[model samples]
Target: MNTSTSGTTKNYRVLLVGDEDNSARLILNTLHKVGLECRYAVGAAAGLSAFRENNIHLVLLDLSTPTAETLCARIRENSTKPLLMTTAATDHQVPLIGLKVGADDYLLKPLDPPMLIARVFALLRRVYVYGGDESHVAKAPPSYSDQGSRLPEGWATCEACNYMGPSPRFEGRSRHGQSVMVCPHCRVPAAVTYAVS
Candidate 1:
């Protein structure tokens, strides 16, 4: 079954693909509480159709979905929005496979409300507000050196989303390699600078 339910406003939209009635209802309820609109589809065909027909900001998929991978690939072809997958299986490989195929994040279900909200917020923060860009400037801790110089600290601000964080993101070499600290709310790569009073 395919159903598109009207939500509060157009500020955000979600495409949910699954056949599990209880899980879908729980998710839809959570999304509605936060003022997000959702469109639900029971299988891959409906999911693909809805995705193409709507202006969706994120996709929440069930790993048990038939042709889950194919559906993800099809969605990725046109949209850059975040895709999150959930699974009931405990096997460690399931989430990995979802990530390998195209999912931006994976979750094990019997859904935890707080975790679900947090992940959704994080994804929405990055995709909708930041669009995966590092152009925004943020404040940094004075003790932190960025490119050898101590940057002035104040706050990292995203003009597009009005997101503010305590520290600007910084780039550094980790054991694994170089990694940049991104704003949790906007995903902007920030610089390490001293906080300005």
Candidate 2:
């Protein structure tokens, strides 16, 4: 079920796709405490629908999700938001497959609430704040690189690789910031600086 952020502004919206009622409940409580609104779906199809219908921020998936890869693919088609997956304790082998299918991180089942919140915060920091093109620490997560990012209006993409950084939306002058769109990894200007015909 979806609810507007009433008491406090909902910082993040999460979708958990699986049948783990207990885990889902725990996650919901943790997320709400941190100003994140988390909603769960029982299966893959419902999960996809919920994701599409709402303004979701992050996604937590259970490896046992029906059509897990398919669900991931569908979500990736529209948004580049972070996706974290949880697998059984002995399922170290699953992250490889999960990554290939577009999942960003994987954790063992029986969610550790603290660690889960940390990962979610980290993921949100990277996705919501860090520009998509950012790769290096200064331009991405591990650091505070707000220099080249369009920041919290226009889209800025690194010319070097597939990395992209999305600016948070706000009203006012379209010129949110400089955001030269440079490569975070190489620290080089994003576009060609040389003369062109």
Candidate 3:
């Protein structure tokens, strides 16, 4: 299903890091069904470089890739973007280690497409749609009241400080020139159309 908010079309970029071409193709195909643009990196180094060079909203790291743990740690150190680890190994410790290294979630290999899509969507919703705070219900921006173009008050959460409360409507432009809502509390750009195509 398309995850865009009502009355808005948002895009997100996903980085798939792995050495297995077949697995990458499968994962990319699954994600594309839901409108996410994906980039594939062959190994840890390439993955790290691609992530650094692009606006990657999420990362899917394959445990089979060499030095995947190091890549996870490196990515986590650099950004708060969501990371998911996939593996064929059933050892419980593998997922634990992946989590310890900063994966937000993990899945087994021979991947189930539906479950994969669900997890990816859930993470994107939690981070971008809800501004990283799950407690608040999403509300559409207030429409112009009878005052002729005057917008009613609105609420926003600062992705930096976790601040959530009411404020006047604050709008800005993203690096990609997309209109976004700025966080009043910290003056940081808070929400935007998330797709990166």
Predicted structure with the largest lDDT when compared to the true one: 3
Error of 1 at 82 (Å): 0.5
lDDT: worst 10-residue window of model 3? 143-152
The C-alpha lDDT values of all candidates are: 0.67, 0.62, 0.68
lDDT of 2 by residue, 21-78 (tens): 6777777776666556677887888889988887677898887877988898888988
Candidate 2 lDDT trough over 10 residues, lowest sum: 143-152
What would you estimate as the lDDT of candidate 2?
A: 0.62
lDDT by residue for model 3 over 148-187, one digit each (tens)? 2211125334445433444434566678999777765466
List the candidate numbers ranked by lDDT, top first. 3, 1, 2
Q: What tens digits encode model 1's per-residue C-alpha lDDT throughout 98-135?
A: 88878999888899764675577567766644564323
> In TM-score terms, which candidate is top?
1
Q: Which stretches of model 1 miss by more than 4 angstroms?
A: 132-197
lDDT, candidate 1, at 196: 62
Q: For all the candidates, what are their Cα RMSDs to the real structure? A: 10.5, 12.8, 13.9
